[model samples]
Target: MKKANTHLVLNCIIAEESITIEDVVKKTKLSRPTVVNIIKELTEKNIVFKSGFAEYTGGRLPTLLSLNANSYFAIGIDFEYPPIRMAISNLKGEVVLSQGITVDRSFSRNRIIEEMFEALERMIGESGIPMEQFIGIGIGLLGYLKANQGISLEILRIPEWKDVDFKKLVKERFGLPVYMQNDIHMMALAEKRLFLTDRADDFAYVGIRPGIRAGIGLAMHINGSFYGGVHGNAHLLGHMTIDINGEPCPCGSKGCLELMAGEPHVVARYKALLGDDPDAESIRGIRDIHARSLGGEAAASRILDEVGSYLGIGIANVVKLFGLTTVVIGGPDGELYYGLLRDHLKKNIFKNMSGELDIIVGRLEEEMYPLGSCFLVIDQYFKEPTLDL
Candidate 1:
């Protein structure tokens, strides 16, 4: 059974990143005996271990009960759209194994799930990692879901998805705990980890994909915690209505952000102008073409620029209202995303608001969503490490 004291110490570990037993006692304000007991139990459970010795305080060197990075591993399952993906990460957030299985419009999900499980087992077998070391599997569905209830609500448009209690079904079938969340929120987890606390706290991440969703993250230095926003739907930026009357969205909104900044809309809007070049149905493909053409193609460049302009309009509003110092754009196409958006956002914020703006893409661009799923699980267990943007 998990004790309250152990939970406190663990929270401290998650909060401070690393600390000594004495530091844990000082921070937690728990009696030395209680701290010691909890530490002992944690070490015995192989959850925590003496990583190293603390600084010389001119006395006996104290031992540190840092989290065991090898203590457990987590599975992050993110759909890369054209290619559904999965990854295995350790407690330290290292990718141990990865695989992707594509599911097209003609594909049957029942067969896809079977293929996914087979691929997962193959990866596990190849990695030589013990099944017991796996803490759980974190899944990122590219749509709305009552994750706790294991119900998906479209965007990815899985056939027969309505009847699937994903979390319950996956857990029961695999005999391992499975946690699911909306992809955008999960990607925000990766964004939070990639940016240090100083730059990341209280920032929001918005991504444009086949759909539009944003994850609002609050770095609570007050208590060393964060809120992913009520059911992790806080940053529904696209639904915020920049234009009261523009385009009709499936969510019953007219002129939503998704229609303006999302991948499908971005490509279709430009494809309408370009006519005969490529059929970009996925964010990944559009991004590839956008990156290639950012150098020469005037038409493609304008599309990227326009998407950035729309993003700037939406993001600038978030900065002015949220007082957010930083806003991250994580999508397949940066050629169109942050560049134009940053240019216009700076202009708007300075003209209307008073705060420094720092907009840059985080580290996990290609694997953003998958890492986001892994990020959710690892973050709950670790401090959700981040890289400087």
Candidate 2:
């Protein structure tokens, strides 16, 4: 309990820069002497320091305390299919340094691990931060993860990662504590901490990636906690069937929403609408589609409209099920198509009933993935059991 209270006090100081003992007491509801004692312990540990003094409106001006951002650091890695991203973050959740490398197909699992370790080693060396200063390494990956057990139950596109004990491997290799979670879940957590702190507690985050191989991903914030259901595979909103007898999915579902609205599908639709035109053949991905849309290509606009309508249907189901007032559409493709998709989503969402629903496009873009992974480590100080007096 004492340790938890100390952590609470530390978080309060971190959240509110240059806070006084009275501020901590009010925020934590701890007694004057207890807050003082905890602050002393934190000051001794060098986790926090007295910054200055507040205005003297009362008897004695209290010493202002601030978290020592350089006292500790954390490493966050987003291990995706092709490119792996890593960042070193300070206690304040600021990314001090970041690096990325693409995985070669010829590389074995051990080789990949070795390369990742080497990159981290180089980063830490470059930053000149001591190993002991790192609290832990947090990893975000695309898959159904047994997060508590640190196991990857199943990962899309990456066959070698299936059934791998990822957390154990990283912990053993780096000799640091490791936390692993679903990439989308980590993104939701990061979004909440970084952007949505003032927003509704119960909302949905839907991310649309570039390919159909991974399809779309979903995460939820419920009652102030990120919800990962039994077996940690709660929000697979992509597989929600939009059409009962439409196209078949690898997951044995028919007419799944991802098949209709994912980036790959949208690109395919654009190509099909344009037929065998050489210009159509040159179009590669969603970015090209967006360019064509901006250039007023009728085919591009039509395809996007179709994709948006399908996406709206999918989002409507999510809203109806969760009774969510806010839904954040994220990922690269989602961000690109936000303007085209907004009207259609609102139309479909309101069809069910009349309520105030805010469907906003996510602002974080690609950075959310790595930042979310970083938050997994940074969030430890603010975890569980409230410091209610």
Best by lDDT: 2
Which ranges of candidate 2 are over 4 A from the true structure? 58-60, 211-214, 294-296, 351-355, 385-389
lDDT of 2 by residue, 1-389 (tens): 89788877988897798899998999999999999999998899788998999988988877899999889888988887567788898888888998888778568777877888898888889998888899999988776778888898876565565788888988987788888877888777777777888998899998777743646788988888888886567888888898998989867899988888877777787788888788877787778887988899888878878888887878877888778889898777666667766777778765555358887777665654777877888786456566567
State each model's CA lDDT, in order: 0.67, 0.81
Weakest lDDT window of 10 consecutive positions for candidate 1? 213-222
Q: Candidate 1 at residue 316, lDDT? A: 78
lDDT of 1 by residue, 1-389 (tens): 23456667887876676789888999989999888888888889898878888788787887766777778888888854446788888776778777777665566767767777787788778889888888788887765567666666555356455546678767876677777776666766766666544664566666655432222122221123344445544456767676787888767889877677666666667767767655444334456547657669787787777767777777777777767776666656544466667777887786545346667675556554566677677755544334444
TM-score of each: 0.81, 0.91
Q: Candidate 2's error at 168, in angstroms?
A: 0.1
Clashing residue pairs in candidate 1 are 186-372, 193-385, 193-386, 194-386, 194-387, 238-257
Error of 1 at 328 (Å): 1.0
- State model 2's lDDT: 0.81
- Top candidate, metric TM-score: 2
